[model samples]
Target: MNIKLLSGSVALALTIGVGAVPSGASEKPNVVLMLADNVGYGDIGAYGGGAMRGMPTPVLDQLAAEGLQLTQFLVEPGCTPSRAALMTGRYSVRSGLGTIILGGLPNTLQEEEFTLGEMFKSVGYSTAIVGKWHLGFEEQSWPTRQGFDEYRVGVIETSESTLYRPNMERARIDEATILEAVPHIYESDGQGNLTPVREYTLEYRRQIESDIADAAVNYIARQAAAETPFFLYIGWTHTHYPSLTAPEFTGKSTHRYGDAMMELDHRTGQVLQAIEDAGIEDNTIVLWMSDNGASPDAAPWPDKGGSNGPFRGELGDPTEGSIRTVGMIRWPEKIKPGKTNEMVAIHDILPTLASIVGADLPDDRPYDGVDQSAFLLGQQDMSKREHLLTHVNNKVAALRWRHFRIYPKAYRGSFSNPSQEGLLGVQVEKNGGPDIFNIEMDPREEYSISGDNAWVVAQWLRFVAEYNESLREHPNPPGVTLTDPDFGK
Candidate 1:
């Protein structure tokens, strides 16, 4: 893996072909993008789990029935990377956020990177993000600084930080010291100033989703009343580690994970109901999706984790289960309600939404996402995307071209160290060249038909080669890794 550090400005320009909004499309639709944390492909009822997984998601299932359900929606392998891809419409590596970010790290979303909030705001839409903003804690990377008009009821870190104080107490740490270091839920003043609302205790964690839902619902009502086209991003913290439910939903399901799932469904329903009450259902584009797949580490916990359907790998692994998760988009009369197996990725959302709202994308840098507005609006049956490169950190781990998944390196996991699999598994170099699996035929990737599908490898290599060639012109910024000599410098 030859990782080149990005230096100076590189003229690796890209031209994206975006479809125009439909004829007579007068009103720009309001967008509500809800991103779930660590929910899997099989976590929801719509994707064939729900009741079977001991958690019934009726709201999500109904949303799927009333809109377009994606069977092959893909994302990055971790939380920060997935969010970066969705916000920038480019590979997370381009923004130097190719992996999960740790606290006190210098790695942050740079101010120069264009975000979805900035893009929507450029088109005169009022934008806000309510909930998890894990990109960075720096003021430069704050949601307000990134072009959002408002940032409320959110955390700048992962949900697991809620357990920090408890874990410190168990280790017999000093109470006052622990209190000083505890994470807090924050609210921003539409400028770069952030105010801590409260300590993110376990009790608060249980009801955090409810608070996020409340803020988002209230924002929607206000925006609707003001008659402003709005882009509301609701980041729901549920089904993540330390899965806890509010008092109302504590025992509503079979287990901790089920309870959390139920809470997630209810909170999501509350936001959707707000949209309906505002009478903006017809002109509102609602997208419900999960950040990544389930964490196998959660399986050993009391919550028992989530189901990645029949897919074999867990969250953060460069496998189908890690990248392929639930995705649904609803726009009453504009987008037809139907399910499709056509591939669409997290990075595609920015360009697709830009196309739908008639916004222009900046052409100075390269973007991995193509405009899928035509396919999304039912103007075309097939998706515009045909290939997606799966990256683990700065390295290209795998390639998905059409129905084939080609892997230049194989992932091998051991029973003694299951958690290590999330870090792209213990990579093993294949001596007989790359392994090719027909994803449609073997969704679990149990068999490698490399001998039979030799031609597919040649085609997949071209995609990889093209990506590498682009990197030569526009090299990626240094991605997070454990082996960097200048650690935390």
Candidate 2:
């Protein structure tokens, strides 16, 4: 993996497809994108966990009740790829972030890509990203440089142990040692300057989530009081690996992971309450989603991390559970409260919001996302998005047709251990004997319909062929640097 920065327009070609057209409404709604780091599909009460799991998420449940609950929402298998897709409205492959960034490497996001912040800013909407920013750690790739007007960023590159790798291997990591491994925090002015706000420590890690909620609420108040429309991207870092529960939330749930989940749900309610208190609830479009599927192996405790509900597989797997998670959108009086089984993904948010705000997406590159504003707003009966190409790392793991999914290989990973590789887990071949699944019926992906579903395989192959051709024409290298020739390794 050669880690050279691809020239902006030269590397990423311009090829725009049709997306959703904007409505004639002159008053654009304020946008609040609340992202949960690793919250699972079954973690919230709306999805079924709630008090039964020792964590009652009443806030998230209510949000779902008052909004559109999308059951088939998808995302990338990991953090970097998911964030890249969400920000650019394109696949992580296009931006070279198909994998997670490791250690200290150059930024994952290239300077040329269009981001959500930049798009909202282009439409005269103030933009800010609070909490985790895993795209890049370098100056040019920071959120402030990527189109945000103001941001509070944390954790550039994830640490394996936050201590010397060699020493950590032999050292017994206790509470004190773990606290010493916390990630640093910073505040940006949306310009080129970044000021150090708090150094990484165990104490900071414990209170960081609460602090982020405070900052977001304050920002919302200020923006609303000034009568300014703003785009707030709150990427909550709770429920991720090394899940830490705040003091107030500790022991509130059955387990540590559940405790963290409770805290995150409470904070989400706080943010939503702030919006209501600002008297802008009716004028704000609030979207709550998780970055990826839950991880069963996050904290190493029994039944810790998150649950993908009835879906099989964990975070890194290409199965339904790894890519499928919770997604909800709320706009009082604008979007009717209901539920839809439509297949929406993280990448769709950018284009959908762009269409709603009458902002133009860059026409220079092919985008994997389709605008679903019409479908989401009840203007269209069915979603315009029908196919989803599921990829893990740089490989096209599986492709989903309307109700069926076809995988080129058999995934044999268990709930305790997850694997993304198998004999045929590469790109799909035209005449490959891939495994087929009616995911709509078997959301767990336990049964294969390959022999009975020849048409599904053929359709999946066609979609793969088309996407492969696009890749051949554009030739996008992975954005993340762990695989780079001499970058991190």
- Top candidate, metric lDDT: 1
**Residue-wise lDDT of candidate 1 within 1-489, one digit each (tens)?**
011212221221122223334423336788999999999988999998898777889999999999999999999988999999999988899899988886666678999988999988987889999999899878888888888988888788888877789889999999998887687888877355889989999888887888899999899999997645899998888888788888999988878888999899999999999999999898899999999998765344686658888786877778898999999999887788989999999988987787677677776777887777777766667787778888885789988888888889887664464444665357778999788888878988999999988998887768777777777777888777754577547
Query: TM-scores of all models?
Result: 0.92, 0.87
How do the residues 1-489 of candidate 2 rate in per-residue lDDT, one tens digit apiece?
011111221121111212222343336788999988877888888888877788899999999999999998999887788899999988787888887775454447888988999988887888888888888766778888899888775555442223343355457666575445445677875355777766655456678789889999999999996645789999898777556768898888768888889899999999999999999998899999998887775434543658889887767657777788999999887688998888888988887787677777766677787777777777768776777787764778888777887788666643334433221123334465888878768887878777777777777767777777777657786454343387544
Residue pairs clashing in model 2 are 13-364, 14-364, 14-365, 15-364, 96-478, 96-479, 96-480, 97-479
- List per-prediction Cα lDDT, in the order shown: 0.83, 0.75
**What is the clash count for each candidate, in the order shown?**
0, 8
Residue runs of model 1 more than 4 Å from their true location after superposition: 1-26, 174-181, 298-300, 415-420, 483-489
CA deviation > 4 Å runs, candidate 2: 1-26, 158-182, 302-305, 414-432, 478-489
For every candidate in turn, the CA RMSD to the true structure comes to: 4.3, 6.0
